[model samples]
Target: MKFLTHTSIAFILLLFASTSYSARIKDIASIQGVRSNQLVGYGLVVGLPGTGEKSSKFTEQAFSTMLRNFGVNIPIGEKLKIKNVAPVAVTAELKAFAKRGQKIDITVSAIGEAKSLRGGELLQTFLKGVDGKIYAIAQGSVVVGGLGAEGADGSKVMINTPTVGRIANGAMVEKEVISPFSQGDTITFNLYESDFTTAKRMADTINNLVGANTATMLDATSVQVLAPRNISQRVSYLSTLENLEFEPARGAAKVIVNSRTGTIVIGQDVKLLPTAITHGGISVTISENKTVDQPNAFAGGKTQVTNNSTITITNEDSRMFTFDTGVSLNDLVRAVNEVGLAPGDLMAILEALKQAGALQGELIII
Candidate 1:
């Protein structure tokens, strides 16, 4: 089968210029101090159907510790047959401004050599933050989305991950991490993507809405805006401010190429200088045939096999094309389609242009 060229299989996205569009401040930026915190803890899962760890020291020690806390002690050097319990690591994300007694979801993952946690129940575990302070307590029946089965002949089949599970609203917040949002005189809005033009435009937009000097552009990422010191008024003020719409700067010129999938995307702003390029490929084909040689009747001669091979080579006609100075993306695509170049050839041409300083944009290959 003949391979398809770029003109046949490649996807070209051409973004044409249109009317200016605006985006809401909340869609492009976020409050600096409003973010989620990661919390983790070590615990155990119980009530497994004989799929738990059998000889893990940590699992046994954790089991022993729990029993000791319950006013029971195990005799020294006595191995416990606790195959119903498995040690696990519990994790949860504590969102900002989470109040005490609020329920949050938690994930339980086995840390030992347990076969599965399909029907396990996580014990009470204290989830802590980076500062080593307990933030929430987790305890619930695990819900596993995976299934596992083992045969007596040492064959096993599994889907998803049986050793990991999640419990919805299983953890209750026990502490609150203080935030500086209500304590500061000014609030900062940080852009998700840093751009000096976007930052300046945001400041200008705010100043136009709430009068001069209301917002200040600090850098490429942050825009500090003056607000009421009172928490209630500040909340209302930010609510109004974040919903305002304004035009942000366009992204920089870039060309992205997926090497594995042969997908090439050229940004609208990408420009090309005056340059000439030519591309072609050579195709080689080979074939073989076999035949048998038989002796005549009563001749007593042995039969032998004969083989024949044939090879053919074909070369594509190379074509040279020129791009004028300050060429747009549309022109580049039109020329490539007219020449019927494949995606691989186009990628090579783009890289060569970049090396020769003819491409006026960034080229990224993934």
Candidate 2:
């Protein structure tokens, strides 16, 4: 009786529970008329810790070329020995509706063979558009990702990846990105995650708020809306439409397994069919301890090598547990894990189950 009650309560919660929270239309989709433009620039990173590019002629030649364009004449073949300069590539996105003077964040990556970018300063870098026009400039102290430490014997330790860094609000826009919403009578809203149910619900929500026939779902990917004929009114109309709230559709059922980290994440929609699974593995660890043999005074024994070795082989080949006729996803995972199956074992088992048509959901391995 207690088991039946608990199962009934859990099943009810699963049906009534919200899979997703409410989000504004702008959060789930984008205004077809307005979008952010991608902007990338090639520039230089300077003030690196003595590990900048070496005395390669191309590095010096590139630096001299840029300097000459800045109206500095240091002769064509002068040996410029700048040890702190490192070439870099800077890139950023000029967001949609970004004004002429607004600031956007930029990411600076080391393109050269610089060992580290800690405490480096970016030079005056121009971010150009695809049309070869300068739109913004980036120059700031980089924020490296990790810390580097070295032991007394020159052994080093580092975490994450310090090779790349970011600059918050680093680039200031000089030219405004062209996003004009004054021409079109209809605008299409593109959902980042396409779902027919969510798309229909969104269209219905918009039409209910602004009366019938205001918004129509063109297909599962886009929803078309009729804006006011006037430019100012159209802008205001679209702004209101982008703020309406509705719940998004549930994503596709999938089981994502990370082999490197032994992590498994199963979506709510994931399911399992009635199937028996048997998986086993073995872990053998070999360890060695070295010992030096001492020679007795009168004996003819020199220094000899004595190794104390140990080998442990753990084989988990227990009897397979029957899943019965009714096995839920959570139950299947728990049953597999009861035999001390590791993450990779679970991944392999899932792959086999998928191949055998026992796993009803998608299995994605990372």
Candidate 3:
């Protein structure tokens, strides 16, 4: 038993040690100007089994336009009863430096009152960027993550979202987006989360790996690194820089409370000042009793209705506790748990502590 216990303890410690180490630069920051662009377009979905939108003027107009493009013209004011088709808005993210003819995935969402998008195929659509320039053409069968079925009695069952679907590798790039990666002798790295300590540490690590004065911290969110003037050498330099690993600085102490879900999260650096706390609850209950008042048999009075009401208030006994100076997060959690407080009560207590200057951390309620 002793041996097994010792082995278990060692395994847990090893796991923690492995996860507490430094992270790679590539995982913490991204090179500036190397990001994806959003593209969107209006399209139509077909092949739905009577589940498509009905009486949609936009869908009808779009269908007419498509037919006219195919050299089939319909008369003016002609209404088409196309219940198997739906108008959809298609969107995709064009990755940086995507070459022409590269295939990308696209998302199609119903723009009408469609019942479901299952078993639908998106027609050929031109996806455009924010500049109104056509970037790619998307067309393929959609794969919906949800399904639905309705009975003749108006009862329906659904799973997930039925109005949205995806098409893997449905868009083929028609144009290439130019990047300025090789234009300058320096490249900037933007941190995912802006922090002065993290920015400084990253700069120092890069400087130590490459050379002195090779990297500089521009601000809490950006770090500039000198690179080779040659494009080939710059690629190699960035590859090496991204693989470097270093420990990041700890973040500020904070407590996050979710009011709707009654969830509370405390940071490791959270501390409590020397203070005393007491917790209790008050409950008010109101009850009503209905009865009938009857007159005596010989009296000529009619029976009357009456109501009896009662109100009660109860206050629970509170327990008092004190915390030493610089109480750790674990100690605070343990003490609170020992008092058997719910998350809602814990939120109230934390707010009170913050107001009284007893909490040494920022309290954020969402």
Candidate 4:
């Protein structure tokens, strides 16, 4: 028998158990025109301890601009050795319906060659949206989650990410993103995952709770519901509609295989066709022995060194398992477990079964 070696088996089986739970409309879908906007800005980080960028042209230009704004101008082409400042990019999400003076968290990332952003403070920066409008202003002390230390001999030790930092409530919203929630007499709910069955069920549930012809299924992902024209009444109607619960359609059967980590995720709806599987393993071992052969003390003969190597191969007897038609997921799992096959072996077995049309589900390998 051919020998197969250098095989390491590690199994992480994720079996999703089937459960019946009614989910609320709000948990499964989101109202149209209710979303956050991304805002980004270029800024500077100051007060670093010799870890900032030393020779970045953009950093120097930004520093010069800021100084000129304060009525302090340096001679043209004069190099300033400001090692405590680093150019950075600031970003934040402006939440929907955010009012003026509202505070939001901001993320600061080094855009220059800064070694670390620890002990740095972000200067005032205006964050702009996709439309080139300033939506928020950010300025605060950065809180880095990582730490680093360096010695004189270029030895360095670091933990986590020392270049990125965050600030809680670092940005103040100066403008609000307009939403169309209050303008339309009918509101549309878009499901996170588009499914025709799910959309129909949601529409039916809403119509039954509110009234007949109150909800309409627009497509596989959106459902429109009629609401009162009055703003106060519309709010109350939405509150009632979001809290109503209904069972969602079962997801499609799928098996996710991670080739790198030896992980297999089996869906609850997976079924097996009638088939027989045989699993076996072959192991190879090599042994080496070294010995020195010396002549008798008075013979004066040269000594010799000898090396002996032994190779052994063993193959386990293959075991067969049979599955009847319409085998459920639980039964398939129990049968596979009884075989006591390693993860690598099981992975190969699943691939073979998929190819042979015995597995009644999609097999996705990552």
Give TM-scores for every candidate, taking all chains together and pairing residue i with residue i. 0.87, 0.73, 0.88, 0.88
CA displacement after TM-score superposition, residue 147 of candidate 4 (Å) = 0.6
Q: What is the per-residue lDDT of model 1 for residues 32-114, given as tens digits with 9 covering 90 to 100?
A: 89889999999989999998988977878889999999999999987987678889999999999999999999999998888
lDDT of each: 0.90, 0.78, 0.88, 0.87
lDDT-better candidate, 1 vs 4 = 1
Residue 21's lDDT within candidate 4 is: 75
Could you tell me how far off, in angstroms, the CA of residue 161 lies in candidate 1 after the best superposition? Answer: 1.3
- Compared to the true structure, candidate 3 yields what TM-score? 0.88
lDDT of 3 by residue, 145-203 (tens): 98888899999999998999999999999988888888888999999989999999999
In model 3, which range of ten residues has the least summed lDDT? Answer: 1-10
Top-down lDDT ranking: 1, 3, 4, 2
In terms of lDDT, the poorest run of 10 residues in model 4 is: 1-10
Question: 1 or 2: which has the higher TM-score?
Answer: 1
- Per-residue lDDT of candidate 2, residues 11-98 (tens digit): 4555554256888998989777587777888777778777567676767877887788889878767888756777778889988878
Q: Which residue segments of model 3 deviate by more than 4 Å?
A: 1-20, 282-317
lDDT of 2 at 91: 88
